[model samples]
Target: MSHKPTTVAELGEFTVLIDVRSPAEFALDHIPGAINCPVLDDEERRVVGTTYVQVSAFEARKIGGAMVARNIARHLDEQFRDKPRDWRPLVYCWRGGMRSGSFVNWLRLVGWDAQQLKGGYKAWRAHVIEQIAQRAPALDLRVLCGPTGSAKTRVLQALAAQGEQVLDLEDLAAHRGSVLGAVPGRPQPSQKAFETQLAHRLAALDPARRVWVEAESRRIGRITVPEPLLQRLRESPVVEIAAPPDARLAYLLRDYAWLGDDRPALADKLDGLRELLPRDVLAQWREWALAGALAPLFEALMARHYDPLYARSQGRHLAGLPNAHRVASDDLSDAGIQSLAGHIASLP
Candidate 1:
């Protein structure tokens, strides 16, 4: 029985859409729910890419065609060896190109109900752009603005725990939104992966509810927010959480004390600040560095850099806010978070 190609959206809820792009391409971006099942492994994709760029198109096709066939044969022997006869698979590649199309053809020939995404990942990307762009404009957005170490993430978590709608943009991007925000030893995903993650998270939310999110610039590392999301955030309500300088300093010290123990890592992370800080300030920070007074230096660093940026973002956001509130909680303890949640819940 010849198998027909299926639109990914048409794949019944149980159908699995497999991504056959190389790991690098897939990492940059892919459909939200798709799993990586490369028909051409990393090295083979590289070889094919190079051949297409350097050698004749005919030669590249000949080599790529054979390699893809071999990969399919191996899958039948190993990974797909036990796949049930009724297993329905939807496959796609970059732009629904030849790699996925070829695999889909092979799977269909083998008598399973296999199909390919009509436009592959390209179609998925378009869908994301359209939804985020048009729908976000009408959202009741809430921007969670606060200084560094003010427990913004903690506040967001508590809100979610209490059944309030919240979006952890940093978590979605697998980033922390500051030089010190990087999780220990975890590499960030590619920009495409970040968007895919963001879109999936957004799609799962009910647009009728207010979406609470941490205040962030358009960019986190190399990943930039899509235009639609940025536009929506621009007009959202801004709530600033104020803390005394000492309180902010203490908070930062507690959150980032581990980085202080490693001077080399600290210096590397601070390298970007050289252009912004004066040599004297840098020397002062270094003196604190040598004396292991990192907590104080970190406080000074916040006042000098992070605080200013936060203030500027707040200024632009405040003007557009239909309702802005200032919360004077520095530590944001359990009671404080619960109180804040109650306040937000009461809002119309």
Candidate 2:
């Protein structure tokens, strides 16, 4: 109990982070690298909360205390039985109050250094927001701009391979940032979790070197870019990769070919364009998708749907993009991308 509270700065490779919050809470978001060893499981937490509000705090504690003790004992027997004496760990709950404090006391009695996060997950969330706000504005960010299917993400991967700092927001969010952006089986993280992931990546980047990121709208799938980072990105210098319509379409066929495998899924996603295009145009695209005519349909989409949206978004949000230095390619092939990446790496 005498162990002082801890901050993120003091955590090390060996420091174990235990999130004592309920599993449901942890799923929405928790500190990165933290493990869930809840003192109260989801249903038990609900029952205890109902008791506190409807019955009384005393009765709730009387009921919850037993559950907490049993769960703690189980953890002690299973998760902590092999721990050495010098093991120091950080434990946190939503507010660093009852849940984490109770767990800390038990660990202290067992002779391990168990420090509570000063203000728990709430504090950690505040830290993420603050760090992004404070550091984002100062970033030497270079936005890689191109219309859809221009292989911007590929270029970014190449840049990273060449040891340049790169941030792939789509990769962090686990989505491609479009109507058809969802990966076939993988789902995007909760907004909070996505932000937490983004914050962690941002923290690791050095501000001195140019950090490259793809140009994206504020919303990527369901993940909203942090405001500070988005603002800085919008204002940063742009480097557009200009691929021909045929090259982009060829690239789209390769990239989005999976959509043709599930006609229903493709049909459903194409339905998202209903408001944007004429019914006849939408019908033709839907027909093409259902009929497995991917190349023609993808071409139509770029010409009618994606290209126009990209143009407007670039003009409205990325003010400097009209004069952005262009990197043209007749091909978006592996070699072409590598060449483009090499040219970009030489930029001042």
Winning candidate number (lDDT) = 2
Clashing pairs in 2: none
Taking the tens digit of each residue's C-alpha lDDT, what string does model 2 give over 1-348?
A: 367888766657336999999999999999889999999999999999999999999999999999999999999999999999988889999988999999999999999888988889999999888888888898898999999999999999999999999999999888898888998778889998988888888889998999999998989898899899999999999999988899998888888889989986787799998989899998888888889899888888888889999988898999669779898898898898898999998999
Cα displacement (Å) at residue 287, model 1: 3.7
Error of 1 at 120 (Å): 1.5
For model 2, the stretches where C-alpha displacement exceeds 4 angstroms are none
Q: Model 1, residue 191: displacement in angstroms?
A: 1.5
Which ten residues in a row are the worst by lDDT in model 2?
A: 6-15
Q: What's the true lDDT of residue 127 in model 1?
A: 72
Question: Where is model 1 more than 4 Å wrong at Cα?
Answer: 1-3, 11-14, 321-323, 333-348
lDDT of 1 by residue, 1-348 (tens): 445555656745436778898887777787767788777888998898899999988988999899998887877687777788888888888887798988888887877878778788888887777767766676677887777867788778878987888888888776788876776766788776677677777777888888888877788766687877787787777776776777667666766777777776676677677888899887787777766788777878788988898777767754554457777765554566677666655655
Clashes of each: 1, 0
